[model samples]
Every structure is written in structure tokens, then in C-alpha cells.
Target: MKITVLGTGEGGRLHAAKLSELGHEVVVGTRDPATTLARTEPDMMGNPPMSEWLAAHPGIALLSFGAAAAAADRLVISGIDGASAVNALSGIKEQLTGKVLVDYGIPFNYGVSGPHPWPTPWGSMPTFAVLDSDSLGEQIQRALPNTHVVKAFCTQEQATVVSPGDFNGGDHTMPISGNDPEAKAAVVDLLKSYGWTDILDLGPLVSARGQEMYSHLHSAIGFALGGDRRFGLKVVR
Candidate 1:
């Protein structure tokens, strides 16, 4: 399988590396491939840059948005923010036509503080920029109607994205929302191959509101439990 991961952030780079490690042909799409590939220093958050990660995943190629999008068999819109994903994809909308897009963007502005954790004095709660009426998934679908968009991996931390079996309880469930049945199944199967055994199919792209809206709870839980890594969600039905 050939996968093209878009965005230049940690999430995009990490997913590209992991998928390439699994023996897929992976190419990363960046705003400026040359500049991104020339970095030697760590990122602003102190994680190693994409240039460094590329060292370990030498099989992967780095290309500009148009080139990468044109070459990929599948697409992963690993946008750091929902708005950026929508904006960036707008330029190459035609390239995404007929491809399955696995969107991992949360539709909230990170500049504003998230919802206050429980038991704290309630005040302004975090609000969604694309909530109540639509979601990031729905927006992408509307923007690229020719593409099959599936929403997955947006509600979890990077550490839990690939290896959900690390949870002691066994299969931790992953919910995917998309209008296309085959596209959603492709996402579920790809995730299953990555060790996520239990997956919940939340019907239609609109259902993504429930999954993406989990960001508030996710942040509150992360703050309440400590840092945001090494945790997984299980639907205990």
C-alpha cells in the first residue's frame, strides 16, 4: 500500500514513520519539502524534526503537496489543526479525488483553552469552531466530495494511535465515522493491522461530532490523570 501523510507536525511525521515501518510505500507532504527536509534541530516542542525521523524511515519519500498527493494510494490528513487541514487540502482538492482520506484533525482552535476540568470552578467552556452543525470530517467530505473521507485517530494521543493492545483490558475500541462504508472499513482494517482489535463504526460522517467532541473530555481526563500519553479508551459494553 502507498500512503501519503500530509502536514508537517509531529502527528503527521509520526504516523508516516510508523506506517512506513510496516512496509508500506509512504511519502510525506509538506508545504516546502526542501526546507522541511533540511532541518537538523528538534521541533519547537523539542521532539526531533521530520528530517531526523526520516533517517530511520529511509524508505519514505518527502515531496510537496501536489507531488505527494498525486503519488499516494491512500491519504492521511494528519493536520495539526482542523483549519490548516481544510486550507491546505483546498489547493489540491482534485488530487484527493477517489482516494480514501483518513482525517486526524480536531476541529477546535488550540489557542483558546480547552474545557475546564471537572470539579473546578466552572467558567468559559471550550467550544468547537465546527460544531453543532458539522465536523472536520463533514467539512472535508463537502470540500472533496469525490474523496471518501473517514474520521479516525483524532481522539487519542500519538502513543496510543498505533498500539492499542498495550491496554491491560485487551481490545480498546476505536470509533470511526464516515459516509462511505468501504472507506470506513478500509480504515478499520488498516487500524486492525496496526493492533487495534475492537473498532466501533459510528455510522455516517455526521457521527464524527461525538468522536471529535470527545476532545474536551480527553483534555480533562489527561489533566485529571496526569500527562496525556499511555492511555487508551475502552467501550465496556
Candidate 2:
């Protein structure tokens, strides 16, 4: 699969590296291509360079922030910060038409102050705000009428998101909510590619409200559990 990861932060870099390692054609889109090239060249051990990486990984292409969204295929997973979420999608809504968009966005407005607050409808939870009044997933779906949106992996800590093995207990389960069956299936497969075997499908997109709220609860748990972001929720029958 040709995957274009938009963003240059840790989340973006992590996704790019992981997908690349998984044998997918991965392109990591950054805000500034030149800066990314310069920084990645030395770090990439002189492996042709970012431009070469793009050429070698033809199917998998890295694009700039705007280009990644405008040229994604099959799936587009967003991990950009809250402030840029709406603006970021503005230019690429057409490209996302009829495709599955996996939203991993948090609504917290960071520029304000302590414990960034989530956007409207997503009220305050114990620690973080309830990210979805109707739900961020639903909002994105509504905003991009042609796209199929699903909410998943928002509650898991960044550490656990990258490496689940760090957790000592049983296998961690990642919950997903989507209105489209086929789109959900595709996301499930994507998760599996990252070694996620236990996936809990929580009904349709409406369930995103609960899923986003869970992130706040998870945040509280992280604080209480001694700053270990490697924990996850498990359902036992």
C-alpha cells in the first residue's frame, strides 16, 4: 500500500518509519521538504537521501503537509495537532472523497494555557476534555461529506501506540468506530499490520463520542498509574 504520512512530529515520523519497516511504500510528508531532507539525510545513514527514499519507495511516497492529504490513496490517518486539524483538511477534502479517513486527532487547543481544552461539544472530562460532543469523528465526517470516517487509537498513549509490548499484562485491545463496514475492515487490517491483534469494534461512528471520552479517562489513568503511558483497556468475557 502507498501511504503518505502528513506531519513531521513524532507521531508522523513514527508512522512513516513503522510503515516503511512493514514493507509498505511509505512517504512522509512534512511542512518543509528542504528542512526534512537536510535533517533526514544524515540520520538516514546516507541511504540515497530523502529524495532517493521517495524515488526508491515509489508506491510509498512522502509528501508535504498539503500534498500528503491531496494525494493519499485508500487510507489517510491524521495525527496532526488540534489547531491545524480543520485547516489541514480544508485543501484535501476532495482527494479524501470516497476514501477512508482514520482520525487520531485530539481537540485540545494548545496555544491557550494549562491542560489544553478540547473543542466544543467535547466537554470537560476528569483530566482532558470530552473530545466529542457529537464527536470529532462525526465532525470530520460531516465536514468531508464524501469520506468515510472512523475513530480509533485515540485513547492509547503515544508510547503504547508505537510499541504495545511494553505493557506487561495481557494483550491490549484497540477500539474502533466507523459507519462503513468495508472502511472499518480496511482500518482493522492496517492495525493488524502494526501487530495489533486485539481490536474491539464499538459499533458505528456514533460510538466515537464514547471513544473520544475514553481518551480523557485514559489520560487520568496515565497520571494515576505513575506516568506510564503503556497501559490499555481490556474487555474480558
Candidate 3:
């Protein structure tokens, strides 16, 4: 499989490494190729740069966003900050047409300010940048009208997304939702290859609202877990 994993952060590099290990033709997409290649320091999250991941994977490729999208058979949209998810993909919209674009992004900002609390009147409600009225997945679909985007792997940590089976025999559920059946199936196959055994199809792309919004609860859990992200939220029924 020729796969383009977008984003230069840990998430993108992680998927690129894993997909490359699976014998797929994987290339990482970033804003600036030269800058990304010159990066000797870890990313903002302290994860080692893409160069390190590439060193371990030897043959994996890296390219600019547009070129990577153009060369790939499928796309794994990773490394997106929720607040800017739409802008991230909008640039490559034309190249993504008819491709299974598996998106793993949450629409919330992550930084030193930490999570954004709810608005004053609804202070109790979970915080988010895109919610209720719209979602990251829907926004991408709207912007890239010709692309088949499937939302998956947003609920799990980078560790969990790539290494789920390592946890207690991998009895967990990852939510996947999108409007296109073929696109969704392609993502499902990819997840299954990565050891995701239990997947829940939450219906149309609109269902992405709940899946993406779950990031609020997910953030709380990650914080509560003393920042350990090795575990996943499994449906126990």
C-alpha cells in the first residue's frame, strides 16, 4: 500500500514508522520538507523528530503535503491540532479526491494553557473548538468535497493506536465513523492490521461529533492517569 501520513509531529512519525514496518510504501507529509529534515530536536511534545523515526525505518519517505498526497494511494491524516484541523487538509484537497483519507485528529488545542474549559454559562460542559454544530471530520469532508475521509484512531493515544494488542490481550473498542463504506472499510483493514480487533462503526460522518468530542473526556483521563497514555477506553459490554 502506498500511504501518505501527514503531519510531522509524533503522531505522524509514529504512523509512518508503523506503516513502513507493515511493508507499505509510507511517506510523511509536512509543511516544509527542508525544515523537517533539518530538525534535530524533538517536536513540541518532546517526541524525537521524524528523522529519528526514519533512521529506524530506513526506507520510509518524506515529502511536502501536496507531493506526498499526490504520490500515495491512501492518506492517514495525523498530527493535526483540533483548532486547525480544517486548514491542515484543505491545502491538499484536490490531491485527496477519491482516496481513503483516514483522519486521526481531535479539534482542540493542546498546549501550556492546557484544556479549554467550557464557556461561562455552560461551564460544566466539556471544552472544544469544533463541536455541537460541526466537527473536524465534517469540516474536512466539506472542504475536500471529493475526498473520502474516514475518522478513526482519534480516541487512542499514539502508543495505543499502534500497539493496542499489548494491553491485556487487546480487548478494547475504537470508534470509527464516516460517510463512505468503501473508505471506512479501507480504514478498518488498516486498523485491523495494526491489531485493532474490536471496532465500532458509529454510523455516518455526522457521528464524528461524539467521537471527536470524546477527546475532552479522553484528555481528562490522560491527565488523571498521571499522563500515562498507554491504555485505551474499551467498551465493557
Candidates in order have lDDT scores of 0.78, 0.70, 0.79
lDDT tens per residue, model 2, 189-236: 988877777889998898988877666566667667764345777767
Q: Is candidate 2 or candidate 3 better by TM-score?
A: 3
**In model 2, what lDDT does residue 227 have?**
43
Report the candidate with higher lDDT, 1 versus 2. Answer: 1
Q: State the weakest 10-residue window (summed lDDT) of model 2.
A: 120-129
Pairing residues by index, what is the TM-score of model 3? 0.89
> Each candidate: how many clashes?
0, 6, 2
TM-score of 2: 0.77
Error of 1 at 185 (Å): 1.2
Q: What tens digits encode model 3's per-residue C-alpha lDDT throughout 1-237?
A: 788888877778778878888899887888888888788888767878767777877888888888888889765655666666688678877878878888877776443233554432223443466789888888888998998988888888877788788887887798999998988888888889999889899989999998888877776676667645466889877
Better of 2 and 3 by lDDT: 3
Task: For candidate 1, write residues 1-237 as lDDT tens digits.
Answer: 888888767777767877877888988888898898788898776778777777777888888987888888765555546867777887788888898888888876644545552343343444578887788888888888899999998778755777666666445778889988888888887887778878889899899988888987877777678744466677888
Which sections of candidate 2 miss by over 4 Å? Answer: 34-61, 111-132
lDDT of 1 at 213: 87
Segments in model 1 whose C-alpha atoms lie over 4 Å from true places? 75-77, 113-126
